[model samples]
Target chain A: MDSAILLVRVLDFVGTFVFALSGAALGVERRLDLFGVLVLAFVTAVVGGIVRDVLIGAIPPASVASWHNLALAVAAGLLVFWFARAVARLSQPVLVFDAVGLGVFAVAGTQKALDHGIDWPMAAVLGMLSGIGGGMVRDGLTAQVPTVLRSEIYAVAALAGGLVVVAGGALGLPPVPVALAGIGLCVFLRLMSLVRGWRLPVARPPEP
Target chain B: MDSAILLVRVLDFVGTFVFALSGAALGVERRLDLFGVLVLAFVTAVVGGIVRDVLIGAIPPASVASWHNLALAVAAGLLVFWFARAVARLSQPVLVFDAVGLGVFAVAGTQKALDHGIDWPMAAVLGMLSGIGGGMVRDGLTAQVPTVLRSEIYAVAALAGGLVVVAGGALGLPPVPVALAGIGLCVFLRLMSLVRGWRLPVARPPEP
Candidate 1:
């Protein structure tokens, strides 16, 4: 395989692992059964990419086309199930993993859209969707409002990183440097937002 | 507007109203707030058509293009809220309306795909997707496994109806008769499944 393909594979696996872990942690937190955990993990890891591919006229998409993504998700699900108690003991690791997954997935999605000849603005939008869509679906399935639609800067961070990639591409920057910079920007923005409790202001409640 | 366009508008409105009512009923069953109810109604009435359009490379989709759909959903949402108790009292009436909605939406989706020059098999698949996608999303949001995946021959009924439309088109049948027969088949199948507890067999549990 070419170096580009090799890089994509590595990033995809990382993104899949992080996404699966976050989903499994949420299922464990909710005390769902093993089957539920696996389902959540699979959905979180693959649904966004599947939707993205379908939109871009790619039949079957990466999730269905490659067994590796499914294997990674299933493996993560089993590991989480077997080590639920031990994993639960570490309080903050899950959140950290989820943030890392979000950054990786957002950058990967933007790159994929750009590869498909989608325009920069639309590619950025698609990237944000890819980062957040799975989490949104997972949260909805667990009876919680999606974090994306709430006050969180989650999608905003993805948008920022995606725009960076677009800008870098426009300036004729190398792909690796552009991707690394974009990913770093996303992680920094997301971590800072979480630490500072930064959020977009909502419409104020009507005065009494 | 042309006569054909006028007919599509009428069917679309009727389908939207029925779908909105069904979604509102589900919100009431879940005891959600008014905002939640409206959101459900809006999503259920439009999401499937939106997905169908997006898949066929129709940007923004009908949900965004036609403001009337949103208005209709909001109106139905308000009506349901105002008459929640009364609506709840009319138990099976809601199901009947839902069946009508399914039939109309399925036929409309298939016809729209055909209009876009998609092949028969793909159009049938898209039709089924348009019929069931919203319900799946709604069920996922409500934290229930989608009924289309678990119970009743919901998507299959849509597929069967779409096949009828496709066959009729291949046989050079007129649009009006083809539509009527297609919609009728869908309604019959859906109502029969609902009444008779018809469901596809689940994969047998692994041996102990």
Candidate 2:
């Protein structure tokens, strides 16, 4: 049990780093200054968690109070800022890391919602929101359509993961196995969609 | 008094309608589809209040739970969508309404934060956030630099209003008069800036 918690914690940190890097990369692409890059990185890595925490009545969200998370996000931003040219070449690895982060956040978010006595349906939705909120905010800040809105895979994968967690919990499954299964489902679906180039159709105007 | 609450509510509704119209207009200018226009309008009209509600631990934000707010936002969006050319001609009225919304939100937000047992400093900050958060989100969704970051007047006006509310509350003044004073300060500042063409200087890179 302790080991499972430790594993999730380690993955959460790694995920935050990769997400922050992605945000910083966008900042560089947009020709933003150092402050802008750092702000983007911080929001991308932490805002999803903060949003989820706030929705579930978690006061003084961990993103605001936890120095470790803040430090990690800022460090990731600095690293990207200093080595942007080198980092941009590694987009493939970054996507994979983002998938991992999404999966971890989905499971963790659902768990937190459940712990707060939220029903499974709402918990599942919040879990998906937790996975996608940061990226949406990041893309929005840069004046782009969020990938989740245009792409089917990412949000669907997170929602699927959340569903698995809720179902497992309802069936009286242990926490460790349930979390692992949810994470596995989300990661697999996300990576698969990327490889397959799957996307949701954009809304179209009716033929006049 | 009951009359004061009623007056604030009426102003709130008016402010929401104008903000929603502004968002919908931006969507039309961006050449987005109907769905995009509605989404932008909804976010712009209600997100500030939603954000404030969440920070103060108000579960199920009234913005989301209240059918009236949602309907008003959606209705305003539809109005602009169907009459884009006409709405564009009324830019003068829109600015005036935006300023009013800023004032009302600033004072109301500060009051709500104080009601939630938050300290005066944080309450003031939250109040300002409530006034600007929706517009920031709207611009972000449309991929623009939030006006709050580049414009000198808007956020400053909101903060000034928040400060007035906090100070008044601290001094044991009555809520009704204090709110009116805060609102007056915000509206006056906003309109003055618009008339004078005031803007904050953008950050520049330091010389090497």
Candidate number with greatest lDDT: 2
Worst ten-residue run, lDDT, model 2 chain B? B1-10
**Highest TM-score, which number?**
1
Error of 2 at A153 (Å): 7.0
Clashes of 2: 1
Tens-digit per-residue lDDT, A43-151, candidate 2: 9888888887777777688778779888998898899899988877875644665677788788877777777777676677677778878888888788778866443
- Which pairs, if any, clash in model 2? A143-B143
Q: TM-score of model 1 relative to the true fold?
A: 0.59
Q: Give one digit per residue, the lDDT tens place, for model 2 in B1-208.
A: 5654554566567767877877777766666656557667877888888888887878766654345776788798888788777766665644665677788888888877887899998998998998888888877776688878775689999999989989987898887788889999998988888888766677789989
iRMSD per prediction, in order: 8.9, 6.1
User: What tier of docking accuracy does candidate 2 attain?
Assistant: incorrect
Worst 10 residues of 1 chain B by lDDT: B59-68
lDDT for A133 (candidate 1):
77
Query: Per-residue CA lDDT of candidate 1, range B1-208, in tens?
Result: 6544555556677888898888877776666656557667877888888888987777545565345677789799778777777777775644666677788888778877887889889998998888888777777677778878766878888898888878987898777778788889998998889888777778888999
Q: What local lDDT does model 1 show for residue B8?
A: 54
